[model samples]
Target: MMGTRRSVQFGDVITGMLVDGVDGTPYVAATLLVDEQLGVRLEVPYITTSDTAAGETPGEWFETKCPPKNLLLIALEGNISLFDCRYSGHTVRHPAGIAVGKITPADVVLQDRKGDHSDPLEVKELRSDIDGLTEWTGFTAITRHPSVDDENRVKKLDIELRTTDELIWTQGQADMALRTTWSCDSTAEGLTINEGVMLHSTFPAPVPVLTHLEEHRKVASLMTFIFGCPITWRSHSVRDQRFTEKRFSQLIKQNTVKEAARPDPTEKQLRHPLASPSQIGSSGLEAWAASYETWGRFIHPAVSALNSPRTTLENVVVNAAVSMEAAGHLIGEVDGENATYDRRRRKTTATFIYRCLARTGWDWSGICESRVGLARALAKNYNTIKHYGRGDFPDPLETYLVSSTATLVVRLLAIRQAAPDATSEFDSGRHFPAYGRLVEDFKNNGLFIKCDGLFAVSS
Candidate 1:
């Protein structure tokens, strides 16, 4: 046979051989083909390189097309692995704040280092105890770009982290992973897509300002809240006697005995053997009561009830002294001159206005200001105490002036920004003025009596 007569020999080979053309150009001798038993083969394919001549090279540039940098993947090492596998295509950049899906430690192995198969350098589970210097992989953007619609929006990001290790690959699974859901909290400042730029602008700087009087006002307000006394008390007793002179005497006698027996401090009774005093307003009650007759009618009867308490009178007196001192300090600080109109007659005239205020239970919130308003408040409280100073209201006479004064001084020190240092020497019992004496000469006497018999108040 002309084709195969015992395989007639020809000087020609097929695959991968270069044959010279008639025009003296070299060409591939064979084309690639696949067989069932053997895989498709790569014949001598053309390769373009920098060393190749312009026309002789298959192409001047090689094109490596890969997924955009935004595609994210988690390596078997539990790290994000980004592929810039694009040799040279279009220049794509990743945006900031882009995240990748779950990266488990089971999927990767570390390369480069030598280790046995039994303990190969493989990904490890996350632990609570990670050292500060330990290096762990996380997803981050390769580049940042602003959103077209909103500049704040993140345009693109390579949410995968890269590692020098093998990744766990399945038959058809893509290299990257996607996270469907996660939780996070919003911060006061908005987030940024780019690490270099902060998304939210900084808040305006605060204006320099100063005002300390407001603090003083607050202290005054709180003081009033805890210690305010009622402004007035209405004596609910009804006079039921018929018009008769001798009847008045019998009536007075009967009422006196009845009042004495009941021992209720609230009952309005004649402290003296004579006339009932006029009911005055809360204003100026202290001065009005200074008269022997006026005080005798209220004070004596009231004191009789107090004296009958069947308790330790010494404790009562000490407590009263302390309270009086405290009341004097507070009222004096606000309006000492008005607290006691005359310096010489403070104890006799001014007295502890706060004590009087406490006695009457006046609402102090309404009366707030420097001197005049405080004076009015004091007068109102005092008058209230005198008229309605009965019942379970706190008494200036019953509270210790030392304790009260100490409390007031402590409070004053707290309220004041710069206060003189307090000393144990000042807290001594001997240093405290007597309660009766302090109230008696509040207008005349100073806080403490000096060796020269002068009044001394805290600064």
Candidate 2:
């Protein structure tokens, strides 16, 4: 029976739940010491790249355990500040982009101390008092996730000797390979290993467990990236919005609106080209939300203002129409002579959707007002897009349309102009566009409309 200690030490036994995933695997957690002493005392030597050697004494470069294929080596001192794992991936080759969750906790174990395996007489357990402790501390520390084949299939075993001592084992290592049990035919078989198994007694007994944390850890790091820089969001926002704006600009240059780009002019299409235009509209709003949510408080006031009622449906329609026309004008100018009907006609067809939406009291003016607001919102969402200016706008426009099914704009146009009487089908709503399929359709039909339910093309 494990004895209860008055206080837990860095090596004290901790009981945590094991989260089993889709395979015959289990994740276990144990209290372990994490600090610089633990890093240095371990005999394994490591070389520090200049990028990671910040404010530290330069030591002789030593070949530690040849880094496991796809594994990164980390060094520690005597502290566990947020900085403990900060410099894990700073090299140009590794870049700060390396995912750190794939490395197993067991892989970070310390060799057992010769005679210190006994439980300490009086151990006081360390309690975490910091907010969001999960983000910085965990019994199972996955130092890094290397891009290795079938990384998920590997097993990691972390054996604790004390609150501050741990031994790590994995299947891939030679001298440190873990000893594992294979239960077959109701009989236990001796585990095979290339290296001698090293076991150590830790202050703690059962370990605290966390499993399937690779993806979660990546998410946490990404969150850190956002919190640390805030500008990354701005950069992405700039790229995405600029991408859209550039596409819009391209549409303006190309000018010709091909009929094929429009929704099939059938009874079904007349009612709901693309399919669920409303959902597409909602998606645009959601995209705006996702972009803004990542930036926190670092956005312009006008950018934040998108949440204001100025984004009413009326505003969306008006801006959408105007923007569509602007896109169309751009397209026409760029591809006026001998322009492929597929591309040019598609732009024209898209504009037609705006015209129909306007005729149906869908509020085209509101969309126009919001166009600038949308641009502002995008600028707020992404700073890079604003500064860089998208070289080409058509692609991003297509992305937005595909994501929101706004490309049903063509089908909507066919319904309004070709067969207004079939307007009742509009109630069916718009569906999201299948980008590949739709693009192909646009390319194939060249001004020919494929009529659906209510969107019959007359001319």
Which candidate leads in lDDT?
A: 1
TM-score of each: 0.16, 0.17
Error of 2 at 222 (Å): 18
Candidate 1 segments exceeding 4 Å error: 1-150, 154-327, 330-339, 342-344, 348-370, 386-414, 417-459
Q: Where's the lowest-lDDT run of ten residues in candidate 2?
A: 230-239
Cα lDDT, all candidates: 0.25, 0.24
- The digit string of per-residue lDDT tens for model 1 on 1-459 reads 112111101121123332211244444322222222221221223444455566541121122222122112222222111111121222212343121111112111111112222231112111011111011112222333444436655665444222221112111111111111112345788643321100011112211011111111221222211121101110101111111111101100111112222222321221110101121111112222123232233222222222334534333333333333444554444433444444555453234534333432223221122323333333333333444544443334323332233233222322121112223332232333332233444333333323222224522
lDDT of 2: 0.24
Candidate 1 worst ten-residue window by lDDT: 126-135
Q: Where is model 2 more than 4 Å wrong at Cα?
A: 1-315, 329-454, 457-459
lDDT of 2 at 230: 14
- Cα RMSDs, all models: 40.9, 24.9
